[model samples]
Target: MSRIGGQLASRGCPHQVKGTTMTTQRETGTAAPHRVLILGAGYAGMAAVIQLAARTKGCEDMQVTLVNPQERFTERLRLHISATGQQVAEMNIPELLEGTDARFVRGWVTAVDADAKIVRIDDNRVLHYDTLVYGLGSVADTVTVPGVEEHAYTLNTAQDAEVLAERLARLDRGTVVVGGSGLTGVESAAEIAERYPGLNVVLLGRQEPGAAMSPKPKAYLQAALTRLGVQVRSGIEVVKVLPDSVELAGGESVAADVVLWTSGTRVSPLAAAAGLTVDEHGRIVTDATLRSVSHPDVYAVGDAAAIRQGFGVMHGTCQGGMPTGVHAAVSIVRALDGGQPKPFRFGYYHTPVSLGRHDAVVQFTHPDDSPRRVYLTGRVAARYKETVTASPWPTYGRMKKMPASGRYQRETYVGPWLPEPILTVGDTADDITNAESVSTAMLVVLETLSPLERAVFVLKEVFDFSHAEIAQAVERSETAVRQAAHRAREHVRARRPRFTADRSRQRDVTERFLAAATGGDINTLMELLSPDVTLWTDGGGKVRQALRPVVGAQTVAAWFAAIGKVTYQGVEPADMNAELVEINGGPGMVFSGLERIIATVTFDFDADGRITTIHNIANPDKLQAIAGGITRDVGTI
Candidate 1:
């Protein structure tokens, strides 16, 4: 028996392995062990590895191998930042596969033998496998754009980013034109504006900037670019590129020193060269399970696979990479076990854009391109974006350890039920307190109540309902609910401290909170959060989240700190206005400005003057009325 045959025999199969071809016996009592080989180490490839490893962890009958040229995973999304002189930490592939049983091979895959199930590498070695996963992400498509190949800088690799960053730092003053107004181009231009304020950044696009995004985000992006002194030129097509300037189709010349090309991406040449069914752009054509239509054993994902519409073919971006990887992995696992293949599904509800440092715009859209009701801008949205990006790795790490039952076996999960009528004053406990705080902040404000007064007043007046509702929901409340709500409000309004020790005295706490959260300042944020502060995000479970509440200032602070490390170029925090108003019964803050109310942070303070509860309202539907009224007012202004 050959190496492949022997491995299969161990899994109770009698198959003959001749080079890369497998010959099965007619009367075999078992099936051969499926061998899966994956290419690339980017998001899609890495995700495939994790899913496959988890699926075949304890199974000895399957073999999986991941091949990539690089040993580390490069965060493609943060390449713009690296190109603009911001240093980013490398995410190690080995670290990502800590306890996984997947094998990693470092080599450049030059050719694919799809029929023979063999991959030829640069080292002249052939790797034989039963199934192949093609996830060669993408490369800069600079060939079509004339002089762009020789002169323009690209944001494809880490080395490229470093080179561009050095060039940008040395330049004194000139127009830096970005040839692409898509997400990457807009993001790059925004980042450059923030870092090198002296340089004139111009963005050129064929369509209006942010055309694919919602109107709310489009407006916010335009405003943010203007605020950052970025000139946006839309409906312009580049005809010729010179050393000193770029000539448009109408023969208009724009003076430029540095030109960044982030317009488009093309599939790897390996796909077409391998004789697989490929699209015009050289992307391999894959089916619903991410398997190549030309070859059942061959799979393609990420930017390399051209999936048809209506069958869950996601084009580009990390959003598409994850699902493709998962599907490919599941396909491989099912093939190995001789089980039915599961169809691939892509889940995405919102597209988030980071504006430079602390600002962000999130646009929610339905699957059919229709605009959804949710649209968030400014600091609150920025924070939400940061939290989302950092959650996957940690969650993935934990999921690897869960039992087959899919629940934490250490403890039995209990549904929320009324235990007893405990007298809870205000929302002192972490869960109920945070929920109440957010509710208050969103409901309070009419001018009259100070920030603290507004928070307390709203919590007592609005949410202090029947004992059954309170007890069943929060697991506490009934005995002293009314008194607690009333006293919490009174305590906050009566003693108004000029400043909280958690925030810097020089800047207003609310302003700084908004600024830091938007700007991605995890350190400053940690300092601002009270010891018992809790950050609650209400995305209605439509988006990615922690699911559970993030408690304690240190823990929440650490989470934000991680966000600060992944610098999104253009996102920045905007000032939020707290108009004093009456809601429910008492006063609360009505966070509004820059067109609408992004969020309202309400607080419930303890008798000792420390903030015991804080709530952040991010549910767009819940705040629609307030936002609509504020938008109308801003339009009048």
Candidate 2:
């Protein structure tokens, strides 16, 4: 009776699952963003959003919108945890994109009018995009075998794993036939067997588990599975899946309480339906630069893209998928700048497979993904795999801001906000002294003036340029530049105190500020701050930094105390969360929360090591390297 009836009729009517949306269509009003619509929030799609959002933070012309069936970021890499009834972190997509100019459309993408550059979302809304990033990633192949879609389970999403987990929990003693011997199947079988020792887990596939790895690592992986009480069945095929059993090739039947299908991967059929060129597997056919060959405006990435490199067509691994996302973003930006999108080059560095939480085997590979003789095993490899699983989100955050921190030009004495500390210098560039000049409280105070006023002041006071040069640099007439410069100079001199701290005192005050902020000791902070000292906090609206400057020492000290209040319940307050960094050209303090930079606390010291002013920069863009940078201290703050 409704728009979803026909599709439900076609699939024989599977009820609405918690995390998936029906492929339904609708129309809606024109969106405000220039609309760079990304269809999937998987590895590649997420890369595109973060890269574009950070690159075009305040730009009015571009809007990055991501469409997914669920609000949570599916840690598909750790779905085995879900299969065993374990809870994983619920990473909210909308919360991640909060401070940026990106929107999250929570719905399954139903249709794409490629010719018109429009997308339909779940029979409710329509979105139009200037450019489309097609990364509606892959899922397990259920159509190849009979009854699998109706009877077996999948680890495709958080909800999918939940369905399997509930069923697994109900079974006190039963054989769980895992009908694939691939990495996902291997991990799932090992997890289930280890957790439910009362049940049997048969890993069935056409090739031996870890068949792609070298002899040593392959043996190590198989042995770990054996130790977990998993039965490995290779050189076998699953012909059918029943409610309580699986039918294999050669008419052999294995009693199965549960079956997990993780065989061949299948992409969504939307590409072919939209008239875009697709490979035999239905993945979007992409050029060297990861753009769609049939429709140049569409960039394909992640598991949904059939991208060919010098090695071969890249398989769907997060290691390779993430690079495709980044490269697509880089190419898109290049095209926007009237430049060419270059080729995407990647290599297989490592293949890490977890046997469970306690054990793993890592296969180091060559550029072509062939297994090298070298490998890692046991706890060392387990920790390495955990690190790999956790690295991507923060790494993408780092890659967002190019020409940042150590690469930009010197900043001026602006009004209230902190100046960008320093542009990184090269071996052939000027010494640290020139870069150090940009980190003073004087430069940060200059940030308070209006854009025009600040530009005129910097080009005149700091650079010592004539009014004529300042006019040209600031794109104003010499008369206007001279007038603006006079007002800026007068305002700065009035606001600035007639004081300069000695080098020794400045260093002492800076260290104390770091110690106080990290320790969250408001009493110590108040002791060092002058009664008239001011504090400015910038969250860029992404984080919870103060909305406005907190004037006076008591107010500023209270703010510092509130920051240290985040004990996260059971977690330790100080465990590599705070560090002393050389921000711009001076000693500064940086704090991190949830693997991302939360804020930067910088100080301007007076003659006797008393704090005169403090700047807190929590803007995601400004704290790009807050978590990890080349400029870290040897020990904690």
Candidate 3:
């Protein structure tokens, strides 16, 4: 029936091959072949190629080629472990692809031509592809910060980790400043403190460390750092990095022998240069289906894409990257087969932060950004982290041959539309609020309409397409498009009231809350807070904040009154501003003024308009987005 059948019949219908099979099958004297060019042999990219090769069993038309700079796939996720002098295992590309029908090309990609559907590798070689999957991962963002390029070292690659390990081994005792106290910072600090007990490990951030993490984990992190004798510095911005010291924004300087920069990440420049639609951080923008907005044949995955719904480009961890790769591959396969690509979806997972060798904190979060539930610390958490690190590889190995299941079948018809909506920084409109609000609005808009009506409304209203354009995009009749749009609008109007928030009332309530927080009046603070209010903070073990939720108005008032007694070297009580803003779908206040963003406060309301939960974003890393270049007057109030 097909060329694949003929080839299999000639080869005794064997599925397993002992060696590399390079035989190309021919069909009807015409080349109905499909060539997939996958870039970057990282976890996601490698998994994509392997899965494609296994699933296209009877497809004689498919050919896969994987391009990477190195011949071996180094476990990049374990760089922190490797940096701590642990022996990291390496996976050989050729050995791993022994039985697979994929070809590996060893060369660094210099340029990509999306329109031509070709990649220019080093040595001036051009490789063409019917479908191109981008999994270039990320590199250290070294721009903007002064003197960092010349002095600081990064733990981005395997080689970089090796260099760091070697440096640590040679050091007897000195100050090591770990910048940006995010997950990477925590891991690096823990590893360094454990490996070299003599060295003074200082974790520096703009806000308190572990502020973005859960309370239990934050407490665990602080305990681990204290136990390991690591110093934590918060609310200080790095003005300049020097050869032997780091200069802070408030004219303060810290002496350091080694500076490890684990700050934010930026997308690979190759994606933007290829004429792909990229965001401000150089991350390629993709539609709901994970296809590039500029090029239909090209797709971007992992740290390279800026998906809607979150800040900071969807955690650069392996968890996000792997799913993105799978989604991109599935979308490409479906598109190639003349079918509509399925939308990508993500759920929150546990975040494990290793504290040295045997201590860790595992923080679990819900899908709706709720405060963490399960908080595991010490040896148990360490073991869990290890298992998590090892689970993905074996799972990927198993997923290599998994057949592609059709669209996810649901028991109930929840409308034929993608759930989450994409959001950007400057996309403020009547319909847009924060990340969660945008996603909710999009879901509500789609859930109330039928399939055809949903498609027409999304194309015409949300995407701002013309009537003719809507018909062309969905391949529908003009009359059908008009009627669908009309019905969809009416349906949306009826269904929209449930999701709408009272912005005026929310802002007023937030301002009232702010007045109570800033006035230092315990009575006012008590009155503003609900009786059952729960507070959450992300200090990341860098700054001192509420370690646990201070429930009840009296307890919260006592906590606020205690703040007046504590004083920093230059900070004063009066130089703070708590402005009302919307965050995480609720009214919130951004606390900042004296050259630093102190905290972000969010309130959850009950049916009686009482606050149920008080969420605070004091994690300096999370606050870095709002922290601007302002000079603080260093004086007592």
Cα lDDT tens digits for candidate 1, 284-371: 9887677888987888888888876453446686766766777777666555445556566554566777778687776766654445
Each prediction's RMSD over C-alphas, in Å, is 19.8, 21.3, 26.4
Distance from true location, Cα of 23 in model 3, Å:
16
Cα lDDT of model 2 by residue, 519-548, tens digit? 788889899899989887655444565566
List the candidate numbers ranked by TM-score, top first: 2, 1, 3
**Cα lDDT of model 3 by residue, 192-261, tens digit:** 8888889999999877767867675677688778888889887868889999999999798999999998
| lDDT agreement with native, every candidate | 0.62, 0.73, 0.66
Better of 1 and 3 by TM-score: 1
Best by TM-score: 2
Per-model clash counts, in order, read 24, 18, 14
Query: Which candidate would rank higher by lDDT, 2 or 3?
Result: 2
CA lDDT for candidate 3: 0.66
Between prediction 1 and prediction 2, which has the larger TM-score? 2
User: Which residue runs of candidate 2 sit more than 4 Å off their true CA positions?
Assistant: 1-33, 396-637
Candidate 1: C-alpha RMSD after superposition: 19.8
